[model samples]
Target: MSSDKKVRQATATVTELILETFRLNGRLIEAGDELVRPLELTSARWQVLGAMDRSAVPLPVASIARNMGLSRQAVQRLAKELEKGGLVRFAKNPHHERARLVTMTEKGRAAFAAAMAKQAPWAEALAEGLSPDLLSEALAVLRALRVKLEGHDG
Candidate 1:
């Protein structure tokens, strides 16, 4: 086959995979929402908490949004709600006067921990037949796609 034909076939396969990924993302969010319900957390709130929990120090809302592939305004709104619920707090950013940093509170940490506990079993069940190697390979592919998407965002 010609190189052009091969490229077209690869593009079509990737397009189908991307569409399926979107469907899977929606389902995963729904499942995550259920998993964090015990902590009175929605998937959106849990996402913000998880981001902060993973960070060693506080992060600006824009940083969090970029890390999570979300809009800065959306993250700011969620941060406000999280703060009102005592799950997170904002502190002055020494580097930036206007952009305060967001940090998870003790309550947020507890909720995140609870959610993680629930996640362990859920993930294990979902990975029952999937090989670790296969998952890692899939992750690499997805990461490459994410990088490509971000590159085009500008």
Candidate 2:
């Protein structure tokens, strides 16, 4: 093959990694859906809850979406749904009048705790044979890629 028509080896490897990441994302979502189903939450909803749960303070939909690498509109919709379900409530944001903060209700906290309880054993099983160092390296690589991509999203 001509050099002009050939892909760089590193580029090809990155492309493969991207494809695998896509597949992994789908499978993870499916597994998350199954894991949280009995709690009346889908993967997306659980993810939103997780974002809120991880934050030290309540966040607006836009912040939650940004934190989760999701679209603000999608997070806004989910926030509304969660509000209606009594899982979360919108509180007045002192910083922004229009962007109300999303706070998890008691029910939301309970559901999130339950979901995490389920995840602990599942994650342990999946990591049974994996080295912690390997996992840390993988996480670092993914974070670096994410930072690079985010920088290019202007």
Candidate 3:
């Protein structure tokens, strides 16, 4: 096969992979919405809480935004809701004068844990019958591609 044809095939495969991935992710997010509704947390807010909860130390708002690939303003808004819910605390950052630290409260941790537990069965169901080795390879490739593409306008 010509190199040009191979390149075109690879591009088409990548595009389809991305589109299908997004479609799958959209449904997952919708599921998250339903799961978190009782806790009065949006799916996005839950994501933030989960991130903070898993972090070893408090993350500054800017760092949270960067880690989540969201804008600072978006993180700030979510911080407000998390604060109102008593799911997160905003503390003064020792290093950054203007940036406040964001961390999940104990309640937030428990809530996130529960939410994850609820989702795990679904994830397992979806991932069932897939080869672990193949899945690992695909994940590694996607992770590399994501890092490479990060911050670059597509």
Per-residue accuracy of model 3 over 17-130 as CA lDDT, tens digit each:
899889978997898899778867778998898778767889987888888878989999999888888888888999998888987888888888887887788779878999
Which ranges of candidate 1 are over 4 A from the true structure? 152-154
On lDDT, the candidate that comes out on top is 2
- lDDT tens per residue, model 1, 85-117: 999899999999999999888988888899989
Best by TM-score: 1
TM-scores for candidates 1 onward, in order? 0.95, 0.92, 0.89
lDDT of 3 at 123: 76
Model 3 misses residue 106 by how many Å?
A: 2.2
lDDT against the true structure, each candidate: 0.92, 0.94, 0.85
RMSD of 3: 2.6
Q: 14-73, model 2: which lDDT tens digit per residue?
A: 899899999999999999999999999999999999999999999999999999999999
The candidate with the higher TM-score, 1 or 3, is 1
What stretches of model 3 exceed 4 Å from their correct place?
Answer: 151-154
lDDT of 2: 0.94
In model 2, state the lDDT of residue 7: 62
The 10 consecutive residues of candidate 2 with the worst lDDT sum are 1-10
